[model samples]
Target: MRLLHLSDIHGRVDLERILRAFNELKADIIVISGDSESSSLLRDLAGRTRVFYVSGNMDSISVVETARELGMLLDGEVLDVEGILLAGIGRREEHDLNRIRKEVKGDWILVSHYPPLDTKADIASSGRHVGSRIIRNAINELKPKACLCGHIHESPAIFRLNDTVVVNPGPAFMGRAAIIDTENWEADFTRI
Candidate 1:
C-alpha cells in the first residue's frame, strides 16, 4: 500500500494545500504523527481518505476526542489495515514500554509522535538526543518493519535499526512529508 506520513502541523489551516498534496501524492493512507490543531479539518479529510493519527504533546483532549469519533485516533492501540499490523503510540509525558511491546506483532508498523532515541531522527537543535528511550528499547525488543515518527523538526531522516526502518517526516507546516511504499518498505521524504 502507498502511505503518506505527515507530522507537526501545529495549527496551520490550509486545507486546499493539504488536499492538493494528498491528491498529488496518490496515497491510499495518510498517517499523521502529531501537533495538529486541525482536528475538524482532519475529520473532514477522513471522509475522503484513510487517516490514522496519534496526538502530540501540544494536542488537547478535545482533539483526541474528535479524532476518536472520526475513527482516526490511533493512540495506544494496534490496528490492522489490509493485513498490516500498526502499533500506535502517541506522545505522552511518560511512555509505557511494556504496553508497546505487547502491541507489537511480527513485522508490525509503529506510528509515534516521538522519535526513538539514538537514531538519526532523534537529534535536537542543541545536538542532544531528546527522543524516547522507551521507544528505542521497544524497537530493539519488538523489531517492527518500520517506525514512522516526527516532532524533531530539525531531524528529518530515514534510517535503519537492524531490519526495521525509522522515518521522521519533519514538520508538515514546513512542507515536509514522506511517502512509504509498503511493498518494498521504501520511504521517500520530500518537500510537498
Candidate 2:
C-alpha cells in the first residue's frame, strides 16, 4: 500500500493544490496529524481519500465529532490496513502514551502530533534538542515499525530507534509531506 502523510495545516484552505499532487501520486491512505481549523476540510479530504486524523491542540470537539461521523478514526484507535496496523494517539503526549501502553498489540504504525524530545533527531531552532520523555519511553517499550508525527513546525527529522523509523512530516501548510510505500516499507518526503 502507498500512503501520504501530512500535518499542521492550521486552517489553510488552499489544500486543493496539495491534494492534487497527492492524488497524482496514487496513495492508498492519507494521514493528517493535526491543527486543522476547519472540519469541512476534513470532509473534503475524506471525499478524495481514506483519511486517518487526530485532534490537535487547536482542534475542537466538533471537529472530532465530524471526523467520527465521517467514519474517520480518532487518536488511540488502531486501523488494520492490508495487514499493517495503523494506530493513532491524538494530543497530550502523556495521556496518549498511557493509553497505547495498555491497548497496543503487535508491530504497528504509530501517529502523533508532537515529536518526542529525547531522540537524537529532535533538534530545536537554536540547535539544542528536546523531545517528549513519554514518547521516547513508549517507543522503547512498544517498538512499533514506524512512528509519524508533527507539532514542532521547524523540526522535521527521520530517526531510527532500534527497529522503528520515526518521522516528522513537519508543517503541511509549509509544504511538507511524505509518501510511504507499505509494500516495501519505504518513505520519501515531498515539498510542494
Candidate 3:
C-alpha cells in the first residue's frame, strides 16, 4: 500500500495542489496527521480516495464531525485495511498511554498528531524536545509498524525506533508531503 502522509495543514493550502500531488505520486491511501480544518478539502479528499486521519489541536468540532460522517476518522479506533491494522490516537492533549495501549493493539499503523519524544521528528524550533512522553512510552510498548505524525512544524523527518518507522511529513500548508510504501516501509518526500 502506498501511504501518502500529510500534516499541519491549518486550512491555508488549496485542494488542487494536494490532489495533483496525490495523483502524481500514485498514492493508495492518504494519512492526515493534524491541524487540517478545511471542510471542503476534507470532503474532496475523502471522496477521491482512502483517508485515515486524527483530529489536531486546531481542528474544529465540525471537522471532527465531518470525518466521523465520512467514516474517515481514525482516532481511538482501529480499522483493517487490506489486512493492515490502522489505528489512531488524536491530539497531544489526550495522550493517555494506558488508553492508547489498550485501544490500539498489535503491530499496527499509528496515526498521531505529535511525533514520539526525543526522535528527530520531535525537536522544536527552541531546540527543546516538546514531544509527548506518553507517545514515546506507547511506541516503546506497542512497537507499531510505522507511526505517522506531525504538529512540530519545524521537524520533518523519517527515523526509526527498533523496527518501527516514524515519519513526520512536514507541514502541508508549506506544500510538503511524504509517500511511504508499505511493502518496504520506505518514504519519498515531495515538496511542491
Candidate 4:
C-alpha cells in the first residue's frame, strides 16, 4: 500500500499544494503526525481521503477535540488498514512509551510527534540528540516496521533500528513530506 506521511502542519502549510501532491501521488492513505492548528482543514481532508492523525505538543486542545469529533484521532488507538496494524501515540511521556510497546503487534506502523533519541532523524542543528529516550526504548522493544514522527524541525531524515525504519518527514508546514511504499518497504522523502 502507498502511504503519504506528513507532520508539523502548524497552520503554515499550503493546503492546496498538499492536495495537489496527494492527487498526483495516488496515495491510499494520508498520515499526519501532529502540531497543526487547523482542525477544520484536517477534518475536510479526512472527508476526502483516509487520514489518521495524532495531536502534537504544540497542538491546542481544540484541535484534538475537533479531531476526536471527526473520529480521526489515532492517539492510543490501533487501526487495521489493509492487513497492516497501525498504532499512534500523541503525548510525549514515559507512560506512553510503555503503552506503545504494548500496543504494537505484528509488522505495525507507529506514528508519534517525537522522534526516537540518538537516531539520525532526531539530531538537532546544535548536533545534539533532541528526541525522546522513552520513544527510542519503546522502538527497540517493539521493533515495528516503521515509525513516522516529527518534532525537531531541523532534523528531517530516516534511520533504521534493527528491523524498523524510522522517519521524520521534516515539517510539512515547510513543504516537506514522504511517500512510503509499504509493500516494498521503501520511502521517498521529498519537498515541494
Candidate 5:
C-alpha cells in the first residue's frame, strides 16, 4: 500500500499542497502523526481519502474532537486497514502502550507525536534527544513495520530502527511531508 505521511501541520500547509501530493503520489492512505489543529483541512482531507490522526503537545482538545467527529482518530487504538494493522499512541501513557502490546497480534505501524528516544527522528534543534523512552522500548520489542512521527521540526529524514522503517516528515508548518510505498518500504521525503 502507498501511504502519505504528514505531521506538525500548524498552519503552514494549505489544502492545495496536500491534494496535489495525494493525487500525484496516488496515495492509498494518509497517516498524520500529530500537531494539526486545522479542522477544515482535516475535513477536506477526509473527503479525499482515508486519514488517521493523533494529537501532539501543541494541539488542542479540538483536534481530538474533530478527529472523533470525522471518525478518523488513531489515538490509543488499532485498526486493520486493508490487511495492515496500525496502532497509534497519541500520548506517552502506560495504558495505551500496554493495551497495544496486549492486543496487537501481528505486524503493525506505529503512529505517534514523539519519536523513539535518541533516534534520528527525535533530535531537537539543540542536539539533545527528546523522544519518548517508552516509544523506544516499544520499537525495540514490538518492532512495528514503520514508525511515523514528528515532534522535532528540524529532524525530517527516514531511518531504520532494527527491522522497522522510521519516517519523520518534519514540520508541515515548514512544507515537509513524505510518501511511503509500504510494498517496498521506500520513502520519498518532499516539501508541500
Candidate 6:
C-alpha cells in the first residue's frame, strides 16, 4: 500500500498542488500529522482520501469540530486500515504510554505531533536536538512498526529504533512530504 504522510501545514491551504500530486501518485492512504490551522483545508482533504489526523498545539477546538463534522477521526483514535492499525495521539505531554501499549497490535502505525526521544534531528530556534519524552516512552513500550510526526519544522529526520521507523516530515506547507510504501517498508522524502 502507498501512503502519503504530511504535516505542519500551518494554515496554508493550497490544495491544488497537493491534489495534483495525490492524483499523480495514486496513494491509498493519507496521514496528516498536525498543525493545520485551517478547518476548511481539513474538510477539503477529508473528502479526497482515507485521512487520519491529530490535533496539534496550534489547532483549535473548532478545527477538530469541523474534522468530526466531515467524518474524520480526531486525536486518540485507532483506525484499522487493511490489517494495519493506525493510531493517533494529540499534542499532550501527559501521554498515556500504558494505554498505547495495550491498544496497539500487529504492524501498527503511530502518529503524533512531536518526535520520539533521542532523535538526532536538529531543532529550529535553539539549534538543539530534542524529542518528546512521551513519544519516547511509547516507542520503548509499544514498539509500533512506524511513527510519523511533525512539530519541529527544522528537524526533519528519519530514525530507526529497534524495528520501528520514526519520521518527522517537516513542514508540509514548506513543500516537504514523505511517501511510504508499506509493501516494501520504505519511505522516501519528497520536496514539492
Best by lDDT: 5
Error of 6 at 100 (Å): 3.5
Off by over 4 Å in 1: 93-97
lDDT of 2 by residue, 1-192 (tens): 877888788877465866786778887888877777678888888887788887777888888788878877557677787788877778666666666676667758878776666664467777766666666777778887788877777787776788778888778888888887776566778774
Candidate 6 versus truth, CA RMSD in Å, comes to 1.8
Question: How many steric overlaps are in each model, in order?
Answer: 0, 6, 0, 0, 0, 0
- State which candidate, 2 or 6, has the greater TM-score: 6
Candidate 5's displacement at residue 24, Å, is 0.4
Could you tell me which residue pairs clash in candidate 5?
Answer: none
For model 1, give the 10-residue run with minimal summed lDDT: 91-100
lDDT of 6 by residue, 1-192 (tens): 777888889897487777776767778877888888889888777777777787787989898778767766546667788888888777654653444556788888888887876675436667676778788788787888888889888888787877888778789989998887777567878764
Write out the backbone clash pairs for model 6: none
TM-score of each: 0.93, 0.89, 0.93, 0.94, 0.95, 0.92
Candidate 5 lDDT (Cα, 0 to 1) = 0.85
Q: After superposition, how far is residue 163 of candidate 6 from its true place, in Å?
A: 1.4
CA error at residue 79 for candidate 3, angstroms: 0.6
Colliding residue pairs in candidate 3: none
Worst lDDT run of 10 residues, candidate 2, spans: 113-122
Per-residue error (Å), model 4, residue 118:
0.6
- Which runs of model 3 end up more than 4 angstroms from their true locations? 92-107
Which parts of model 4 are misplaced by more than 4 Å? Answer: none
Q: Least lDDT summed over 10 consecutive residues: which range in candidate 5?
A: 91-100
Ranking by TM-score: 5, 4, 1, 3, 6, 2
**What overall lDDT goes with each candidate model?**
0.84, 0.76, 0.84, 0.83, 0.85, 0.78
**Model 5: lDDT of residue 45:** 88
